[model samples]
Target: MNQLNKILVLNAGSSTLKYKLFNATNANKTLALAPMISGMVEIGEVSKVTHKSHGENPKKMELPDANLNDHRSALSLVIDLLCDPGFGGLASKSEINAIGHRVVHGAERFKNATLITKDLMAALEASIPLAPLHNPANILGIEVATELLGDACPQVAVFDTAYHSTMPASAYLYGLPYHLYKDHGVRRYGFHGTSHSFVAKKAAKHLGKPLEECNFITCHLGNGASITAIKNGKSIDTSMGLTPLEGLVMGTRSGDIDPAIPTFLNKQTGMSYAEIDSMLNKKSGLLGLSGDADIRNLQDRFRAGDKHADLTLEVFAHRVRKYIGAYLIQLSPRLDGIIFTGGIGENSWILRNKILKDLEHVGIVVDKSKNEVDLTSQIMSVESSKSQVPLLVVQTDEEKSIAEQTFQVVQG
Candidate 1:
């Protein structure tokens, strides 16, 4: 029997930890679409753990009474579940050859998947200020995994900002003092790079061209959204700046606002800086506009003739459309394709149609029939026959991308 290397991918959010276990080999072939085992642990007062195994007879179970109050306990429970005879794919934790973590901010130092060493951990710790909400959880996952899995099992840090490292100074720099960028790294470090890079590769494959030869615009429109202009498979520009809150209008995030709005609000409402920040990041966006953050609910409201929902949906579409127009100009003349991925981007055909409505004059014509389809698990071209550039919906797999990079780093 051929030996298979077990690679575990971990994405630790502020209050949740998600994991996937893939059986990999050093062969030049495609990895499996689904993982052998996948699970998530929600950490809180009443913690819970859910596990699922994929195969001929897939099984899923939930432990609502899990005693996981922190990331360490959460990950330890994940290890236990992975070794549980009936629910796990591994015989023991030692079978895990390498671990991959989704580190949110790599700053300017890491441009690719890096093998996690003591120095790398320190570097990641240094970047915590750049991603206060995300990096701590990611670092906690790495630390706990290292303590549990020991030094024998290699680990890799797959950064969310690595792919955007290819962005030029013209795109990344803010108009602030040059010293801010030189000393503090205060510039546009785009997020969702893993999804963008993964979908861009898929789109390039669908176009029958090498990624390096393709110039395209990729939109990753999830709860946290960002759009990128890819020139020759490299990110030349992106919407998100410095943080995930600067891009397209998202679930709860106020995408782009006047720079002085916060200060003005502080003066007017006497709210603290932290309070204003929380309101912008948590109380704004669709929720602030329409009183609801979920797009499906907002779509239903829009269909039911709610004027507020209508306006909110229009506002959301307008921002996305504006970015598409800007990126189109950035990759003009030789633009190959435009891609849509993420939850809302993949399923919300209404928003897609709204964004593409009057873009035909710019060669972006969407086929109504092709635009409306179930694209959750497959790739489809929604561009009309008359459209100059192909419009594709490519489902993103960041975990798979992380696993692949982790395997490569371990092999080397």
Candidate 2:
């Protein structure tokens, strides 16, 4: 029998805890999906909780809403399900070797997955201003996990920003004066590093090519989108910067807007600074374009001749195409292919077809029929005799990557 390292991977979002229990040491299958569990919590209304396993139907149990809601109770519930033998828990909590928390912002302090220590938690807290919405919950997860598991069970911080730390000054820096960057640490700090890294490696696997021998433009297009140009095995460039708001058009984000527009809107409309900030972050993007940002619904509307939905899809594709063209120039001679992943990139055949439709001039082409078919392969490439730029759609697994890294870090 082969021994496997069990690492519970936790991706704590604002109101959702998306997790998977993975056997990190299984050479034949490095990661196994946990019974998926998620749903609303102490959010807008009362703190309502809904839970589920990956394969089971969602079951509900209610209690008085926790006044000061946070990740603690959520963590407790998670532990209970894992430890309770009657609940079909995977292991008797003790058998679970470690924890891996998906931390969105590690600032510059963390570049590698570090064992969650008090000192590390302190650093995560200090960097909260950089990612006020995300880092706090990440810190809460660490604190709660440490409290429950104690120092004996190793926990690791898998940072979303760490992989992009390799970006050079020219790629990360803005044209603003040097003092802003030096004094305030105000510069591009890419998010979704884990996803980009996962997709890059996955791309190589699909192409049957050594990662060191290939360079491609990787697009992680979901509601929150980011384009990355991976040179060989490393991240040469990516879309997200400073915060997640600086990239491609998302479900509800104003990506790549004029920096001065916020101030302009505030002055002209007598809107509060907070209001403008919230507007750009919460009420823009495809939502503003199509009257609804949902891809499925919006696509349905487009088929029914809704001009706005069509326009929204066009803008989204245009934004992507522009970036694809830009990255082509950036990696000119080394560009081998264009790869797409993330929610929309993985499932939406129409979007993929639209994005790659006109790229023939750039040696980028796709087999429409192959792309439309569904199959799980490392590489989802089109079978085209004359196609130059190899277009691929790869399914990414950032959580498994985190779990693998967590196991190694704990073992080492």
The candidate maximizing lDDT is 1
- Pairs clashing within candidate 1: none
Q: Provide TM-scores for the models.
A: 0.97, 0.90
How does residue 29 of candidate 2 score in lDDT? 43
In candidate 1, stretches whose alpha carbon ends up further than 4 angstroms from where it belongs are: 1-3, 28-34
Clashes of 1: 0
Relative to the unseen true structure, what is the C-alpha lDDT of residue 216 in candidate 2, on a scale of 0 to 100? 83
- Candidate 1 lDDT by residue in tens digits, 286-327: 999988999999999989999999899999999998898898
Pick by TM-score: which candidate is best? 1
Candidate 2 lDDT score at position 256: 93
Candidate-wise lDDT, in order: 0.91, 0.77
